[model samples]
Target: MTVDDIDQELLRLLSADGRRTFSEMAGEVGLSVAAVKRRVDRLREIGVITGFTVKVDHTKLGWGIEAFTELRYAGATPVSAIITSAFAVPEVQAVYAIAGDPDALVHLRVRDIRHLQQAIDRMRRTGPVVGTKTLMVLGSWNRDDPAPGPVSDER
Candidate 1:
């Protein structure tokens, strides 16, 4: 469970490109392919590396509208109930347990403004959600094509 420098390096490489061959990663990290594979498998086993998948641009997929909704619930609400309500709607992509005025923050994607409104309405109708404030997303970007945090000589 203790991740060493080599393990961090392997994680960084895989985060950049999950499909990168172990041999290719070996060249970058100065390890044998088998060694890299072992580290990666261990990373998975220990839950450091969970699962890999393709990233898609939601806008390009006709989901042109995105929104961040801050949900307010009555006093001392359980987070599991909040998550369950959000996940029941397919438009909800990510849920954040917030620390401020709002009980939770949710990132949602929809085909258009109408769809966004519908998703918000659905969340509001959920039993424990007292209220919600939604903010429209203008644009976004990702740097994960080459993920940060290199395993430098600091190890």
Candidate 2:
């Protein structure tokens, strides 16, 4: 489906706040409410708007630690098998099969350091996992947020 400029603007607004009302979007984009609704419906019909989701603070929900574990598997390990092994551990949030030395990268959220270590151990023990390297997340920034302006030094 071809997404025109108006469609692009609608998408950006919806992505920033999924619960934003159609009327508000219509006002922002200079279109009638019904027109905005129709455009949005068309976007969904074409599968561009697959679904809406809520972003949560994992730290507030008792998940104090977040980490990424790079997994190296045997030469013959299938991608599906790797995904299955990672998903078996409940803490595994996302699994990315990449094209490099490490076969996959697994995102995990856990309650504490001990929980993180346990999840890593579980992954290591599963399937044809040859090696695993985990990196702890200290902070993160999303592109959706406004970028900081250039730094200046003057006194």
Candidate 3:
């Protein structure tokens, strides 16, 4: 699906706030509400727009501790299975099959250090997990650049 200017505009507005009504999006994108709806449906059908979700504040929810765990597997273990098992745990936010020394990397959110330790213990028992290195996130700094504009002057 080739997204034109209007489609891109609709995506930008929707990405920032998915709750925006089709009428409101139409006004912003200078298209009819029906047109906007059609484009949105097309985007979904083509797998451009996945799903809309609310961003929860983990700190407010009493899950203040964030940690990244690097896991190394013992000889020739299936890393995908390990990642799937780790993600099955509620505390695990994200999992990645990585290269280099570590076989997988897991991002976790927990209530505290004790909770993190318990989760780690469960993960170690899952399979051929050889070792794990954990790094506690003390604070997070916003480092993402602004989203790309409609067209680039450099191009």
Residue 1, candidate 2: how far off, in angstroms?
1.5
True lDDT of residue 147, candidate 1: 40
Candidate 3 lDDT by residue in tens digits, 15-93: 7778999999998888899999999999999999998977677999899999999888888877668777787678899
Give the Å shift of residue 4 in candidate 2. Answer: 1.3
In model 1, state the lDDT of residue 93: 95
For model 3 the local lDDT of residue 21 reads 97
Q: Give lDDT tens digits, candidate 1, residues 80-117.
A: 88888889889999999878789999999999988989
TM-score of each: 0.85, 0.90, 0.83
Q: How high is the CA lDDT of each candidate model?
A: 0.87, 0.92, 0.86
Instruction: Return the TM-score for candidate 3, rounded to 2 decimals.
Output: 0.83
**lDDT tens string, model 2, 52-153?**
988788889999799999999987898999999999999999999998889999999999999999999999999989899999997666755456576667
Please say which candidate is ahead in TM-score: 1 or 2: 2
Clash pairs for candidate 2: none
Ordered from best to worst TM-score, the candidate numbers read 2, 1, 3
Candidate 2 global CA lDDT score: 0.92
Window of ten residues with lowest summed lDDT in model 1 = 146-155
Best by lDDT: 2
Report the candidate with higher lDDT, 2 versus 3: 2
> Evaluated with TM-score, which candidate comes out highest?
2
